[model samples]
Target: MNNADLRQVVHANSGTTCQELAEMFSVSHETIRLHLHQLGKTWKLSKWSHMN
Candidate 1:
């Protein structure tokens, strides 16, 4: 899946971490972080707070 798709999953499960997401998507942790950064711009403040 693309970053946007992965971001949606992350959004739905706010407590999940970048590493977890990367594992789930079979991507690198840095890849997850990049998507998270892009997603963060549009993500709700409440959601962003869940990042570790």
Candidate 2:
């Protein structure tokens, strides 16, 4: 899947980490962060939260 797909998955599943997602998507943690930024989003509170 693509970065956008991976981002959606992470967003859907709360409390998912950049490292974890990176490993799953075979990309660097920074790459995930970059995508999130491009999407105008980010994991809040330094930890993933279920609340949107």
Candidate 3:
């Protein structure tokens, strides 16, 4: 997916951890984290402990 779509996905799932998001997007967890960090939404990507 494109960056915009990725951003939307992340925004839509507030409590999802990077790992979960990565799984959903078929990408690596670190890639998801990096994308969010680049998008300035690292705060939106929940830490592992906060994931449901």
lDDT at residue 28 of model 2 (Cα atoms) = 93
Model 3, range 1-52, lDDT digits (tens) per residue?
5579777775666677777788888999888877776676645333322222
Q: Residue by residue across 1-52, what tens digits does model 2's lDDT show?
A: 4756975786688578889888888999998877766666667876654334
Q: Which pairs clash in the backbone of model 1?
A: none
Global lDDT of each model? 0.68, 0.73, 0.67
Candidate 2: Cα lDDT at 13: 81
Global fold similarity of model 3 (TM-score): 0.69
| For every candidate, C-alpha RMSD to the true structure in Å | 4.8, 3.4, 5.6
Rank the candidate models, highest lDDT first.
Answer: 2, 1, 3
Structural similarity to truth (TM-score) of each candidate: 0.67, 0.69, 0.69
